[model samples]
Target: MNSVNNTDAAKPAAGLSINKRSRSWWSAPLREVLDLAFPPRCLLCEVIDYSSNSHSGSYCSECAEQLCPLPINRCLCCGAEIGLYSMSENGCTHCRHRNLRFESVTCLGMYEGPIRKAILAAKWSFSAVPIRSLGRLLATERREELQLLKVDRVIPIPQHWRQRVFRHFNPAWIIAEEIASALQVPCDAHLLYRQRQTRAQKRVPVSQRFGNQAEAFSLQDMHVVDGERILLVDDVLTTGATCSEATKLLRQNGARECHVAVLGRVLDSSA
Candidate 1:
């Protein structure tokens, strides 16, 4: 009576292992049946994608081509598209005189065409498909360049709790998670937080954008960021004010380096 029932104790573990194996075995066939029943459609254009490289069945061939990395030259400092002969070593004309806190910026493409439509759809749609697709595409397109940075952590530019409640989802977090998964780094959504509500950067005038973002963010734990190379992610970069403020906070907290990644970069200031 006092002795433990070793054989009985082992039964539970054995049963759990068999259950896991059963689930794994059935998963692929189940997914295949589901796919046949409801063929995958492009998230952006809602067209059935028959191509193999449909980006996990998220985009059709035409939309995929539209979302491919742009061939235009981009400023390393601010991610602005520059003239073929324009200097980009220090900063482009767009950000040369401005105080941009991030070391460098990377983006999938300019904020127009399919990229713009995908981003705009992501905002109002409750479905995670659009944002997740955009995030995965960004990760796939920028894998090599992002890997070179050797990022220690991925952090999304956070939203205020009120905004989060209103929006019901944070696109940045999803994007950061995808990039972090690709980079094999941790995505810490809670590391940085917006401290107060501010006017949308798009709505604010370019001249007042920096002031609008001033003191808008705070960190949860500075110790986690100390000496770490961080990659800050967001859905779009308009004037670079929001990301700059976030990067400034990370650097002030002792982050070794901070890099920015966004799905879209607005080429026109008025956009």
Candidate 2:
């Protein structure tokens, strides 16, 4: 009986030995706690954990260095990649032909490579942290541009109540809220509402997306936005249709001016 008791006592030490040999036992929980407490590394580089409550992952400094931020010389209207320009230039070719409702659209990066992947993953996967990180990045990178616009409010392109019921979250709301907090501007999410459920814009052709969202939005409380320089926000901008439609609604409701901000901007060949 005494021998048996001693043998049982030895088992715990053996288990501890095994745990020490593997190293994973310690790292798994340590990683979890660290991830929870610290900013996670970037997904692209996997070395720098950005804890800004916006970005997460393991990618570190090198990954940030690898990212290709949007060029400053891009056309103000279409966000198209362009060369050095004079201040007097009226508008890009696409803008000249299209007569857009929004005063301008500014984006953080081209909708390709890491920027696009991050936006897609954050949207489809319900990864709020990454979207927030992208939003903060936009705020930091475009501070000068945002200051120039003198935006008064941050209005997220709202999700319809029906879609919100299923998706459990709104990506645009996440972005807008973060930007609003960073910029010290008020976020007026309830000011705009999606009156109808339009099919997901991804499946539709670019030409048709605008019409699809033509009547998708309406002002919920015009007084909130009246006489304000509104900043409309979204995760990605493909055809400018979604933003344009939202702009028209804001204008109709008496917003002083509307400017669009996005994390990713799709490369339109036409521009």
Candidate with top lDDT is 1
Q: What is the C-alpha lDDT of each candidate?
A: 0.82, 0.72
CA deviation > 4 Å runs, candidate 2? 1-40, 48-59, 68-70, 86-89, 269-271
109-194 in candidate 1: lDDT tens per residue? 88887788888987778876678778888998889889999999999899888887788688998888789878878889987888
Model 2 / residue 102 / CA error / Å: 0.4
Can you give the TM-score per candidate against the true fold? 0.86, 0.77
1-271 in candidate 2: lDDT tens per residue?
A: 0011222345665578775678876876876687678646556545545442223332344545444474667767767556676331466754556556788778877777777676777677655566666666677667878878888899899998988888857888877876776677777777788989998887777668778898899886767777889999988776788898999888887789999988877755521
Q: Evaluate model 1: give its TM-score.
A: 0.86
- Model 1 bad stretches (over 4 Å): 1-37, 51-57
